[model samples]
Target: MLIAQLTDTHIRRPGSLAYGVVDTAIFLEAAVAHLLALDPRPDAVIVTGDLTDFDDPQEHARFRQITAALPMPVFPIPGNHDSSAGLLAAFPEIAGRCAGGRVNYVVEDLPLRIVMLDSTVHGRPHGTLGAEGLDFLDRALGAAPGTPALVCAHHPPFLTGIRHMDVQNLFDAAALEAVLRRHPQVLAYTCGHVHRAVTTTFAGLAATIAPAPAHSVSLALDPAAPPTFHMEPPSLSLHRFAEGRLVTHRSFIGAFPGPFPFFGPDGRAIAG
Candidate 1:
C-alpha cells in the first residue's frame, strides 16, 4: 500500500498571498496535480496540518474547492492557524462523524491504522496535548492491539534543535511519550509544524516531520543566530509498505534544472 503525506499547506483565500509574497494556493494545486499523476497512485492522502493561513471561512471553502477533484480520500486536521468549529461547519460530513468537537480523529485503514491527534491549542502558535488527548490515544492504540499503526499530529512532539521552531514544539511531550510507550504497535510519529524535513526518535519509535509544500523554513542551527526563511521549491513525502517494511521517499514537485546521468546494468550506460 502507498500513502501520500501533504503538509503545511498554509493556504490563503483566493487572490491572497502568504506573508505578502508566496502564492500558497498555486503551489498547492501544483503539488496535488503532481501526486495525481503518479503511477499506481496512493490509496489515500493524509494532510498533516496548517490547512489555512487565516482560518477564515472563505479560506476553508476555497480549500475544499481546490481539493475536491482529488481521486483519493483527503484527511486533514487543524493547526495553530485553523479554527476547529469553522472547519466542522464548512464540511458537515467530517463534522457529523467527528461530532463537531475537538477535531481529533482516528481511522483504521486496515493493515495500517492512523490516529490523528489534535495538538492545536486555541489561538496559540505552539502545540500541547492535554490529559484528554493522551487518554484518547491510549485507548485507540490499545483497541487496535498488534496492528502496526502511524500516529499523526500537527506539531512535532520532539525537539528539532532549530532555534525558533523548537520553542513551539509540543509542550506536554513527556505525557505523550508515556502513552506511546504502552502502545508498541505504533510504527512512526508523523508531523508537519516545523516546515522542514526532520527525523528523530521518540520512545524508541521513529518520528518524521514532512516538508512544507508552500515554502521552506530557514535553517537555524545556531541558537544566537536570527531566524530566516526560504522560498525553495515545494516537496512532500510518500510512504510505501511492501514485504513488511515501510519505506519513505521525499519528492520535490518541480523539475530541478541540474542533473547527472542514469545508470545502467554493469554500472555503465547502455546508450547516450
Candidate 2:
C-alpha cells in the first residue's frame, strides 16, 4: 500500500498568501497535479495538518476545491493553525462528527488501521496530544489489536532540535508515548509542523515529519539565527507498506531535468 502524506500546506484564499510571502495555493495545485501524474497512484492521501493559513471559511472552501482534483481519498486532521469547527466544516466527509471537539478518528478500510490524532491546541502556536486525545487513541488501538496501525498527526512528538520549532512541538509526548507502547501493532508516527522532511524516533517507534509541498523551513541549526524558510524544493512523503514493515520515501515536488536513461543506445553505461 502506498500512502502519500502532504502536510503543512498552509493554503489560503484565492488571492491571499501565507506568511505574506508564499503563494501556497499555487504550490498546492502543483502538488495535486504531481500526484495525479504519478505512475503508480497512491491508494490514499493523508494531509497531516495546517491545511489553511488562517483557518478561514473561504480558505477552507478553496482548499476543498484544490484537493477535489485529487483522484484518491483524502484524510485530514487538524494542526495548530486550524480549529475543530473549521476543519469539520471544511471537510465534512473526512472530518465527520465525532464525540469531542477535536477531529480524532480511525480508518480501518485501508491496509493500515490509521489513527488520526488531533494535536491542535486551538488558537495557540504550540501543539499537544492531551490526556483525552491519548485516551481516544488508546480506545481506537485497543479496538483492533492485530492490525498494523499508522499514527498521523500534525505535530512531531519529539523535539526537532530546531530551537524555534522545538519550543512549539508536542510538549507532552510522554503521555502519547505511554499509549503507543501498549499498542505494539503501531508501525510508526507520521506528522508535520516544522515544514521539513525529517526522520526520528519517538516512544521507541519510527517517526517522520513530511516536507511541505508549499515551502520549506530552513535547516539552519544556529541557535541565534531567526526562524526562516527557503524556496528549496518542497516535497511530500510516500510510505510503502510491505513485508509487515513500512519504508518511507521523500518525493520532491516540481519539475526538473532528469530521467535520462542509464544505458546508452548500445546498452552501455552513459560515459559521463
Candidate 3:
C-alpha cells in the first residue's frame, strides 16, 4: 500500500498567505496534484497536522474544499495551531470518534492500522500526551498487539537537534516511548511539527517527521539560531508498506529538470 503523508500545510484563507509570504494554500494544492500524478497513485493521504495557519473557520472550510476534491480519502489530525472543536466542526464524519472532545483515534480501514494521536495542547504551542492520553495509547496498542500500525502524531517524540523547535518537542516523550515500546507491532511514529524530513528512532523503531508541502523549516543545528521557515522546495513523504515492511521515501513537490535516461544510447550504463 502506498500512503502519502502531507504535513504542515498551514493553509490560510483563499487569498491570504501564511507568514505574510508563503502561499500555503497554493503549496498544498500543488502537493495534492503531485501526489495524484505519481506513477502509482497513493492509496490515501494522511495529513499529520497544521492543516490551517490560524484555525480560522474560513481556513478550515478551504482545507475541506481542497481535500474534498481529491480522489482518495484523506485523514487529518490536529496540530498545535488546530483546535479539536474546530476540526470536528469542519469534518462531521469524525464526530463520533472525537465525541469525547479529543481528536485522537485509530483507523483500521486500511491494510495497516493508523493510530492518529492528538498532540495539540489546548491554547498552547507545545505538545504533551498526558496521563489520560498515555492510557488511551496503551489501550489502543494493546488491542492491536499484532497488527502492523503507524502511530501518527503532530509532534515528534524525540529531540530534532533544531534547537528552536526542540523546546516544543513532545513533553511526555519518556512516557510516550514507554507505551510505544510495549507495542511491538507499531512500525513507526510519524509526525510533522518540525516541518523537516527527519528520521529518528523511538522505542527502537523508525520515527519520521514528514516535510511540509509549504515552506520547510530551516535545518539550523546551531543552538543560537532561532526557528525559521524558508522557501525551500516543498516536499512530502511516501510510506510504502509491502510484504510486512514499511519503507518511507521523501519526495519533493515541483517538477524537476529530469527523467534523464540512466542508460547510454548503446544500452550501456550511463556514466557520471
Candidate 3 clash figure, as a count: 0
Q: Give the Cα RMSD of candidate 2.
A: 1.3
**Residue lDDT tens for model 2, 1-272:** 89999998898877777778999989999999989988799999999999998899998888889999998989999888888789998887765546677888987789888889888888998888888888899999999999999999999888777889988989878888999999999999999999999998888899999999978889978877799999888789999998889999999888989888999999999898
Q: What global local distance difference test value does model 1 have?
A: 0.83
TM-score for each model = 0.93, 0.96, 0.96
Kindly list the per-residue Cα lDDT of model 1 for residues 27-132, writing each as its tens digit.
Answer: 8888888888778888888888788888898888878888887888787878888867766777676675574387777877556888888788898888886887
Clashing pairs in 1: none
lDDT of each: 0.83, 0.89, 0.87
Ranking by lDDT: 2, 3, 1
User: Least lDDT summed over 10 consecutive residues: which range in candidate 3?
Assistant: 91-100
Clashing pairs in 3: none
- Judging by lDDT, tell me the better candidate of 2 and 3: 2
Model 2 regions more than 4 Å off:
265-267
Total residue pair clashes for candidate 1: 0
